[model samples]
Target: MHKASSDTLRVSVVVPVYNRPSELRELLAALVLQSVDSAEFEVLICDDGSTVDLRAVVDEFNTMNSLQIHYFRQHNQGPGIARNLGLHNAGGAIVAFTDSDCIPEPEWLSELIGPIETSSVGMTGGLVDFRTADHLSGRCVNYLMSSMLGAGGARDPRAALHMRYYPRAGNTAVRRELACAAGGFSGQRHGEDIEFSNRILQMRTKIEFVPTAVVVHNEKKNSRQVAMEAFQKGTARIRLAREQGVHELIHTLPALLVVGLTASALTGLFLPAFSKIAGIPTVLYAIVLALIGLHGGFLLKDVRALLLLPFYASLMHIGYGAGYLYAFLTDPSTSVSLERQTVAAKSPHDGMSEQ
Candidate 1:
């Protein structure tokens, strides 16, 4: 690709990295091959206290590619803080956000930035495709994400025309000025992107969802990893609801059903009449699981994945339910402060790789 004029750098792609050096390298490699002019865009790697020095990686890419690559290091803050730092230091007119683990397509930047450059929209988001659809756990995660059944509700872009939808930071672009005015990203351990997008929307800025600008996200979570992620996501959802009062009924439905079934089952132990009532929620849960399995199987084209769907789905529901219940029992008045305290205590994870 030809280089653009140095005076007209149009886009700056900011990525947050924790400890995934190989993934970061892969993402940078794909970025260097973008269809847009190398000089038109820059890549900023915000290192969040990774054990290894990433400056070497950034310098190596800078030496080989025509595109400008910059690196910034910070304490063990979360991706939100890292992104804010990048935004503060960015020199381009538009800021694109993606994860260290995502590989953007050749025209990803060009397509994502088109609407903002050509239309009144201030921000644009694209689709994220899994690199491989062969793994059962991976397929299950993708299914939940697409359906917005669990933590996926926060990142779902397939909302009704009248409903509000937010673009995920993993594959989104925004005008620098609008992003700055929106206060960039909140420094929460999770749900920071959703909060930021909502702030932008509240400002009356237009946001567009572009399916053509795709990125490949390599998800290789096993059953245990999926379970942990589900639990963490559930916790984050409750925290988000408590902080923003944005309750997603769809996401909470499964958890509520699970809770109801458990409560009924427990009451049945004491009262014979409640025994029969307990079966109702169980039957309903089975039907939901069946539908989820059937849909996942159809999408993955693998009946084997369907066989494992119920187990994974159950884990997700239980984890989310537990988190919701925990948050509900705790004092809502102190949730915001508690959330910040929790984030301060925990180290930043590879936020970009999450669903």
Candidate 2:
């Protein structure tokens, strides 16, 4: 990559880190290999109160690559706050956000920046994908997320037939001034990216979704972690809806499936004939998931991964459903009201766009 003066910089790649020095190293290495000129872009690593000293990792990269890398340290607030610090300190006109665990493709920065610079759009985003499945949980989650039944639409805008594409921090770029005008991220731990995107929408800022700007997410979580992520996503959706008034019916599908399956199983225990009828949903769901798993296995050449999909799918759906129910039923109005208060306390200009 060509190196130029920092005065000519066009993009600021902001990554928030939290106790993941090794992952941060990998991401920094990938950033050094970006197709964009090294001087055209700079990196700001915002540490979110990590117990492990991450400065060494950033310093190592800076020395080895002679890259324009800056590091900031803050108390353990959250990713949103850390990102805001990066944004505030960034000097580039374009600000790109990605996670510490993601490794961007060579063309990732170039691809995302081209659209944002050439067009009238205020923001652009790319696909967050997995190149390999190292573990069973990764395999299962990757397979499910890549399918139409899962978040294929979310990962690729062309496939978003029913779902709308939102700019996630994991692979998104925005005009720095526009983002600042929109009040930056809202500091929500779970769905801050989506919440920030909603504010961008309120500004009527056009966002382009570019599928080629790929970032390989190095997610190596166990089954329990995967389930917990889904559960948190479920709750986050509700919180976002309450705060942003952006609701999607598709988010409730898993919860509905959970309720239906539970009711059907209970009814089947009392009526033997109804048991056969009740088994249809479960059977069909299993068969479809199994088929998806088989397809994944065929593509990856791993039969063991195929066998575990159904169980993983069950965990994803049930955990998400339980979380959705818990959030929705646990003093719904009070949570919404309190959330508003908290947001107001944190940042007065968070969700409001410049009028």
Which model scores highest in TM-score? 2
* Cα RMSD to the true fold for all candidates: 6.0, 5.0
Question: What does candidate 1's lDDT look like per residue over 105-153, in tens digits?
Answer: 9999999999999999999988876425434566567666655443344
Worst 10-residue stretch by lDDT in candidate 2? 340-349
TM-score versus the correct structure, for each prediction: 0.85, 0.89
- The parts of candidate 2 lying over 4 Å away from their true place are 1-6, 133-136, 160-162, 335-355
- lDDT against the true structure, per candidate, is 0.74, 0.77
lDDT of 1 at 137: 65
| Model 2, span 1-355: residue lDDT tens | 2244436888989999999888898899889999998878888889989999898887788778767888888888888888887777676888899999888989999998998888898999888664363355665576566556654355566653446678888899998887787777766677788888888888998988888888877768777887898888778878877877767777788888888888788878988778988888888777867776777678667777677766777777788877888899885885453121122122312332211
